[model samples]
Target chain A: MSLNATLIAQLIVFLILVWFTMKFIWPPIMRAMDERAKRIADGLEAADRARKELADADTHAAEEIKKARAEAAVIIERANQQAGQIVDKARADAMLEAAKQKAQAQADIDNMAHRARAELRGQVATLAVQGAGKILGREVDAATHKALLDQLVEGI
Target chain B: MTTEAPSSSSYILHHLTYLQLDLRTWKIVENSQNFWVVNIDSIFFSVLLGLVFIGLFWPMARRATHGVPARWQNFVEVCTEFVDGQVKDAFHQKSKFVAPMALLVFFWVLFMNIMDLLPVDSLPTAAEAMGIGHLRVLPSSDPNITLSMSLTVFFLCFWYSFHCKGLKLVAREAFFHPFGKWLLPVNFVLKVVEELSKPLSLGLRLFGNMYAGEVIFILLAAMTLHYSAPAHLAPLTGTAFFIFSALALVTVGLVAYGKGPWMRAWLPLLILPAVIAAGSIFGFLPAIGGGAYFQILFATGWGIFHWLIIGLQAYIFMVLTVAYLSMAAEHH
Candidate 1:
């Protein structure tokens, strides 16, 4: 192959191509690739953060549920204690009222017995006085009869 | 096959000749001894291929996105990334110029080499129809074109060496480091040869490979002329039938050897040409006729093999350029 001016022409062309590529072709493509790499990195980091936050939320929800369950148990235990105290007080009040009524009934029975006894004794004295008068077969002295009636009454 | 066919030697010469323009005479010439002559065909094809490269890449470069890319954009991005990776591997220092230059060298050379795969006569024959006397479609096959590219890369190396190492160190290292200043003249000569050989090897290696490949294709084409004569038909037909039968045996052997997918896929590529050549020889396919089938068979085979050379040469050229530049830029 002969060396000719064609070599120079081709050299010029090659240089032009190199310049064109450097000026127009290389930078934008490199920038895009770099930007894409950054975007992917950011996306992965965001996904990692969201996963961590989700784990945190899961633990917090578990704790809240645990606390709510404990509070519910305490309220139930207090209600049961209050219910027992109310039932015991009601039973004690009913027993005290029953004992007081029984006592009053006993008092009323004793007082009524005393009044009936007094009336019966007076009737017996009158009957004895009448029988003595019949035995005497005449009118006896009143003052002497009064003292004897009293003694008869006291004996009845 | 034409009514009056050219002799095989003349056909081969005609294919190899360039459509050169003589600057001294200011006219297209058959052949020129003038130093000012330019091979118009090589220049035209090389420049067109370069334009095609830039045109295809320019749009993608303009619209490149950080988001998901379109299919064509993806292809361009892959090529860019591949070239960038090669440059990054070889040239550790950051330089805006090297990667793009590598990209241009690779794709441009690749495009030029691919022209060889076009049926050797297709473009030249069409070019002939347009009153062009001679045309060689492959630019890399031309010494001027390959040397021009390699020389440009060599210039970049010189620029980087001087810029990075500075004048004193470069001269001192050139004259001293490889051997020593005690043998100054010897070191100088050795350095000169070593420095010159980088571009020489880069340019000539590509030219030799592509030139040899083109010559083989021309020879395969010339075979059609050789065998198209009635006197040669019997031998041609006999050879075709032999090759067909041999290929059949190979196919059978491959099938018996556990029929790998690669064997299945490639066997057809090897067999199809033989089938056509044989069929044409036997008058089973009279349309192609005669020894034209031989051209088809060998050309197809060579063209397939040349595909590897085309891609490989381009890659080698790019990688070597990057390596040379990296070496030039490296600090002692």
Candidate 2:
């Protein structure tokens, strides 16, 4: 084919297409692409921040659990010590009560023994007087010997 | 089919001719060396294809989003980004014009070249019914269109050279740098030739590839023009060609779909049947009369291969334009 006016016509058409594309087509698409890129970057950054915060919260929760466990262990140990003291006081009180009861029983026994000894001595003296009266054929004065009998009882 | 069939050479010539119009006389042009004549068919097809490009992209451009893009928008973005990537790679300078210019050249040329893939006679025959004597659908095959595009790039190179390097530096480098001022005349002549050759080679390379491809398609179509002619051995040759082609198709299908170590081992042996099949087809070609079946086969194969050529030529044209502009922009 030979060079003709068509070449000029095509050149004009080509220029117009280029101009149209530059004016109407390129800017909007490029802007959208750049805006999308920025949005993606921001989303990724937010995700990273959320992950870091979650990790921090996980560590904090674990520390709190450990602290609560330690407090529980301390409270259990103090309760065990208090229980031991209460048991020791109860045993001491029981022993003191047993000792006091034993002392009371011993005092009752001693009083009874003294009364029996006095009665026996009075009977012996009456028998001695009766035998003398029988020998002398006369009664002696018993009221006069009461003081001696009382002293004899005390000595016994 | 027409009762009086055209000869094979005439068919081919008819396909090659363009629908031209003389601007001065305002009439259809045929067999004239007039400088004022324009190829109207090339202009119509090119402009129509350009409109198609704009139509496809303009809507998507309006709906482009910062969020997830629709499929059509994604496709448009992909094309835009690919051209942008090419412009950025070759032309390091930031300019508003180069990327869009490259996009226009690439898609416009690509659409023009794709016109070759249509059945060679389909549009021309329909156009003939409308009383248009001749039509060539592929615009890239016309030297006028390709040269016009290359010449535009040439002007762009000159514009950028003057803008970026200034006239003083460009003129100085043209006369002095390559061979020094001692050989200024030789350097100037060499530089001018070198500068002129860029557009020449750029335009002709595309025209040459497209023209050769168009010619082959026309010739393949011409092979079926003798359908009414009688051949003595037509039935036998036709049957033989069919059987061999079937065998070839089966072999190809097996290689494509069959799987396992046995298939791999049989791969080398497979070539034997293919070679024999090809040999038989060519051997029976002469006796097959019209050979319409063979024409279909060749056209299908060539059409598939031309897809690669079409896209590649457009890409090459766009890349070379960017490279030339970048070279012109350089100081030395």
Candidate 3:
């Protein structure tokens, strides 16, 4: 085939195709590829940030839980100590009250003993006075006898 | 068979002829080419396939997704990316046209070169059936078609050189290079030759190789076929048939697998003649189909090997185009 009109036609087709491809085909696909690359990069960055945040949150939560637990332990120990002090205070108060009541009861018993002794002496004096009167065959007076009885009691 | 086919030589010659249209007369011509006459088959196929190439990519370009691409889109994208990468590597200056241009060149040549794989007789047989004649489909095999492409590249070379280097330096470099300003005349002639050779070789190399390959296919086709059976050879029977078959098979194997220097040297002298004689002897045996078995062996073998050549030719054309452009654009 001699070089002819076909060359021109083919060259035109070649140029047109090349131009069409350059203008329309290339830019968009390349842009899409660039966009895709950026998306992937951004996605990976977000993932990295999220992982860091999650790790921080995990550590923070653990710290908060640990603090709460420690506070609870301290509270429990303080409560135990306070409870022991209360029990000791109650025991001390009860011991003091019991000692005071025992003293009061012993004092009452001593007072009753003293009264009985005085009463016994009076009875003895009266009986003695009455027997003297009976020997002398006369009646005994209470006013003079009372003084004597008191003196006799004092002497016993 | 098929309307009593012409002699094998005529078959081959007919296949080789192109459907030409004389531009001056505005009339169709065949059996010979004239000035201003173009091979319409090459033009038609080239234009048609060029459109198809663009058509294939057009949709992909439109709907090209940022996400997972469609299969066809992926294919187009990969090819584009490859060409883009190659251009980036080669050309220092970023030209918007380079990658897409390379893409067009590569796929266009690829599309044209692949036409060779179609069975040799298919197009011509179809043409004859249609009452038309002499349609060669493979466009790259035609020098006009290939040279047109390379000439386009050649124009671009100077275009870029003048554009990038400015007219003064281009003129200076063209007029004086290795021998310097003292030998301007020699340098001018040498420069012209050098410049002409770049595109010349690029175009002609592809043209020659492809033309040779087409010729070989034709020759192989010729081998299988015979117009008239040799009048002497009667139908074979008994031991003679087996012996001829054995000899033919051996010759075909030797011809097919014989890459050795001895076989290459002797093939024309001793081997081919022996095979032909055997083929005539076995021509009456319809199962063997004359010497066509050997033709089938070589054709199939070469056809298989031609896949690499097709891909490589397209690749080489593209790479050299880029290299030429790069040298022009970046050269100080």
Candidate 4:
């Protein structure tokens, strides 16, 4: 064959090769590739979903923590208020007890003084009656004894 | 010498030649004078081969499962992905249809290439007995098939360019950018050459590689036949010679074994001896370098070892196609 003929033949063959392959082989290949890309996109979507769930859980946990802290603060404040009331009540009761003890002591002193005074008066009367009876020197009647005692008492 | 013994080289060359067909037309359209036609044996077998490929793959497509694919289904998916990945990497533009087109090119071309791996004498000898001639089964080896397939791809590329960019944009790319408005004539010429070269290079590359490999295998078989040992010597001294050779080989093996531990300490020392031994035993290793055996080796290696390439190529192609379509849709 001439060089030109050979080149033309080569050209024709080349054209045919390209034609057949493009028609038959390419479609299936592209379909498979599309399937693969879709699979990857799906995997990414799953990951995103998991991330969202995780973030929600974290937010929930933080909310729970804040609620618990608020509850603890209220309980602590209540306990402090109750403790202050108890201290104030104890002080008031102690002051009342001290005042009652002072009053009782004062009343006992007054009663002791009155009883001593009465005893002293009785002793003095007895001594005076004995001395008068000795001076009169007789087992006199009630009217004579009385008249002597009266004269002695008037002179002292 | 009563009959000259046929030399091994001549034997090999004879087997490799194609049976020719005459399809030339001389007077108007009645009788063809000297134009070639399809070899009867080749046509029958090539069709049969095409059917076999379709049969193998079509069923996988038909019974494609939706969820948690079976082994066969997975295999198909992997193969598809591999082709797509390659296409995506090579061509950046997304074609609504071009990526799939590239995929078809890869697989069909691959199937055609694999036909060369069949035994050299099997198909042709069978055809001869059946009174048929000019059998050429491997389509990749045929320039006609390869070039035709490549040109189709080239045209598809042009179609995609035209469809995606529009006629005006394609024209601008062809005649405008590289050269200024002043050099539109020169730019047009260069563009034409560039466009023409695509299919020519692509088709020729695949065809030449496959055909050369087929020629080499035929040559190797001829060598084995020519180097056949004597007939009478097989019975008489064959057993004694075998025993002697076996003993020598055993001794050599023992020496090599003893040297292995020492050799392990120094890799450089062992490399030469290993190469020599391997070369002598395998007879220079078939197909030298990058021949048919090499091509098969490379293809098989790619299939087995660099499997990632196949899948990646498929993926890239698919994504690019999608991206292109999305862009084109926006324009519309």
Please, what is the whole-model Cα lDDT of each candidate in the order they appear? 0.82, 0.81, 0.77, 0.52
Q: Please tell me which predicted candidate would have the highest DockQ against the true structure.
A: 1
Model 3 chain A: weakest 10-residue lDDT segment is: A1-10
A99 Cα displacement, candidate 4 (Å): 3.3
Off by over 4 Å in 4: A1-81, A105-109, A112-156, B1-10, B17-36, B40-82, B89-93, B122-135, B154-198, B227-332
Winner on TM-score between 1 and 4 is 1
Candidate 4 has a TM-score of 0.54
Question: Using alpha carbons, what is the TM-score of model 1?
Answer: 0.81
For residue A38, model 1's alpha carbon misses the true position, in angstroms, by: 0.7
lDDT of 1 by residue, B1-332 (tens): 23246788887888889898988888998778677999999999999999879877887789899999765677888999999999989999888899999998999999999989866765664454345778898999999999988888889899999998899989998888767779999989998898899999999999999999999988887777745444334334334444554565466456334345766567766775676455434431112546667777898899899999999999999999999999999976
- Order of candidates by DockQ, top first? 1, 2, 3, 4
What's the iRMSD of model 2? 0.9
Q: Please tell me which model should have the higher TM-score, number 3 or number 4.
A: 3
Q: List TM-scores for all candidates, in order.
A: 0.81, 0.78, 0.78, 0.54
Error of 2 at B37 (Å): 1.9
Candidate 2, overall lDDT?
0.81
User: Could you tell me how far off, in angstroms, the CA of residue B77 lies in candidate 3 after the best superposition?
Assistant: 2.0
RMSD of each: 9.1, 9.6, 11.8, 12.5
Better of 1 and 2 by lDDT: 1
TM-score-sorted candidate list, best first:
1, 2, 3, 4
